[model samples]
Target: MQEALRLNKPVLAICRGMQILNVAMGGTLIQDILELWGGSIKHFREELPEHMPAHTVDLCGEKITEIMGKEKIDVNSFHHQAIDRLGTGLLCTGISPDKIIETVEAPGYFWVIGVQWHPELMFNYFEEQHNLFKSLVTKCLENMP
Candidate 1:
């Protein structure tokens, strides 16, 4: 992820990938969401259906709101760790109802974005989620050598 960011490559990081992206860029993680940042929201919901909407993330970043084409989105959560201090050059784009970071983007990069939720599992059910994949592919194509 650090290399990709250095090379200005298009990236669509999800779940742990998002954590990796943040760490690669000098950001920190909460280690354990429930253990440290306990709240009404369940950050890790393995018992629930994988495709079910676990919670909603409010889009705040202008770039993300534009990419998602909405102010809010429903997402499934299945991770205990999340981005705490944002990485250098990265911006918080989305957040859960309980204020957990759900999505981030590196505005300096060509198309580097990360999401805490598993969009690959939710794309089939949500058109917006599917569009996330499409956007990455499109960015890759547009920047192809």
Candidate 2:
């Protein structure tokens, strides 16, 4: 990841990958979101139906809103840890109703998109989820040297 970022390569991080991205960039994780929220938010939907939408993440940051073309997106949640401090050049793109950072993007890179949810699972049901990959590929192709 360090090499990719240094080379300005497109990077798409999902779930724990997002966490790792943050750590690599000198950021920190919340460790346990449930403990912080004190069980208020339904962030970890292990008991809910697999396909059921867990929450809505508002695409507030400029890059993600432009890529996703929507103010908000319904996503499947399955995370207990989250980015506590955004890394250098990183911006909080999406936020859940509970104020959790759901998405982060590094504007300095050619393409660096990190999401707390598992888009691969949600893509089977949601077109927008799949579009995330399409956007990454499109940007990558456009940035190819």
lDDT of each: 0.91, 0.86
TM-score for every candidate vs. truth? 0.97, 0.92
Worst lDDT 10-window in candidate 2 = 34-43
Global local distance difference test of model 2: 0.86
In angstroms, how far off is 62's CA in candidate 2? 2.0
Clashing pairs in 1: none
lDDT of 1 at 56: 98
Clashing pairs in 2: none
Candidate 1: which stretches are off by over 4 Å? none
